[model samples]
Target: MAFLEIDSLHKTFGANTALHHFDMKIERGEFITFLGPSGCGKTTVLRMIAGFEAPTRGTIRLDGRDVTHLRTRQRKVGMVFQAYALFPNMTVAENIGFGLKVAHRPQSEIKQRVDEMLQLIKLPHLGERYPWQLSGGQQQRVALARALAGKPQVLLLDEPLSALDAKIRISLRQDIRALQRELGITSIFVTHDQEEALSISDRIVVMNEGRVEQIGTPLEIYNYPRTRFVASFVGTLNILSGHVIDPSTGRMAVDGQELRTAQTLPVGDAGKKRMLALRPEAIVLEAPAAGRNTLTATVEEVSFLGAIVRIRTRVKDEVISLDIFNDPNRRLPERGQPVALGFSHENLLVLEEGVQG
Candidate 1:
């Protein structure tokens, strides 16, 4: 049985539909992230799960029990929002203990749990400090602690790390993931940041315009994107358009060149259109190697990005991008130089012809 399930959950505000039959199943103690761009209804879905918003249609089941109509305070779900939402007038200890106190827990028990929560966030020493006294990252950690103090069944984090600096965001994400693992709590994280979702989530739900585009492990979403939107939204990819030359064999012709693919062309519209999705890391700039997809491309741009060198090449009318490890001894290729690019059949994904967004 699923720990939490959202079945055909529909939400509408006036004439605008926020979620269109959105659905997902979350396992017990699993970390699933709702990933999408702004105004894509990811946060709206999180709010529904947390009981802050009611769905227009469909049922929300928690551990086989329906909780669709439960109030926010009665759903037993903890939430940490983007702004930290810490009360500037309250100290960290008071904030963390607020939930327990509101529930009328004994003073000694609240004190003990607050102390443990502080220690869990690695800031036991900052309990007496106000929100203003703490750094942005530290303040967010306190917010997390306050949320966890309630010991809810599910933890919903809505872009909690987006407000922090890059360095602090990186560090706190790892810390949050570690704390979740230690506690074995089911978590639903919502974010638009691709890197953040890829690094932290066990599974990612790529949302677009109130619909679920794809849901899978990070590797599956990145390497074998089911649709054009998933391929472009989840990571950097080179989309090449073509037509299926052999409808029976799933061979596609790209810019007059044939490329082998793993996906069979869908029936009835076989020769109409086709496309291939290839990742930047999958394509390599090297001499013609045996038994690999080789394309002779003219180098157009070379960018140095610290650890790896990004090279843009022109193959016919389309510009293909590939990344190579930075080698100090190797001479950087000049612009307009002709280079052979190679990729394996496994790396080149044949997909339906569609514009990546």
Candidate 2:
């Protein structure tokens, strides 16, 4: 049996639909992320799992037991939100021990658990400090520690690192993943940040309009997105409108340029409409190459972005971006310089022509 299961869940707020028959299964000790933009129901799903928002339909199960109607306290699910939500009047140790205390645990047991939680979060000595005295990162850590104090069955994180700076967010995400692994806890993380979800999750569930669009490992979702929306929403993609031709020959035309793809093009010639999703970094710019995939473009703009140089080029009437590695020894092409764009057959991802807006 799966460690955590959300089956055909649905949620609505008056006239607005928040979730639509959403389903997910998380194995024991696995970290799954719900990734999407705002109003996509990532947070609504998390709230359902945390028992804060009851699902309008379906069941939530843990260890093969139904928990759909259980109250928040009865579900034994720990949660950390974007806001630290730490108690200002209580010390760090007191905050961590609050859950145990409310459970009617013995004084000695609460004290021991509090001490262990402080050490687990790497703030053993700062247990006496109030929330106002801690840094933003530290306060979030305290929030995490408090949630884990009682050793709940599952941990739900709702943009827990959204309040921290970039560097701190990265560091804290690593820490959270490490701790989750060490404890072998089933966890669900909700975030709009693609990089964060890709880096920290064992698998990601991409959502749109309260429905699951795609669920796969980070590499699968990023490299072989099944839909146009998933491909465009996940990362930087150069979308080219084209028509497929000759399924047996594996050939297509993009803006009058013939391209090769491993995928079988549409046969029977029913208009043969299709689209190609290409990554920016997959394109290689050269002076000229003897191939059909090469296109001459004029460099319109160049911008340095620390580790990479972003070059904008115009081909025909469309502006496309390419990222080149920064090298001190190499000379970059100046603005308005004509260049050739080349790409491999493997880099071209062909998908259905239609896409949802």
| Candidate No. with top TM-score | 1
Q: What Cα-based lDDT does every candidate model obtain?
A: 0.89, 0.86
lDDT of 1 at 231: 87
TM-score of each: 0.96, 0.93
Candidate 2 per-residue C-alpha lDDT over 1-357 given as tens digits, one digit per residue, 9 for 90 to 100:
789988899998998888889878889989999999999999999998888898888899988989999899888889998998988999999988888899999999999999998999999899999999999999999999989998999999999999899999999999999999999999999999999999999999998878888899999989887678788889988777766666666677766767777776546743476777878897878755554366678899989999988888887755778888999898888899998888777778886533232
Local distance difference test, candidate 1: 0.89
Superposed Cα deviation of residue 136, candidate 1 (Å) = 1.0
Per-residue lDDT for 214-298 in model 1, tens only?
Answer: 8899999999987788888888899888777776666777777767776666676477675578999998777977767788889
The candidate 2 region of ten consecutive residues with least summed lDDT is 348-357
- Could you tell me which residue pairs clash in candidate 1? none
Instruction: Supply the TM-score for candidate 2.
Output: 0.93
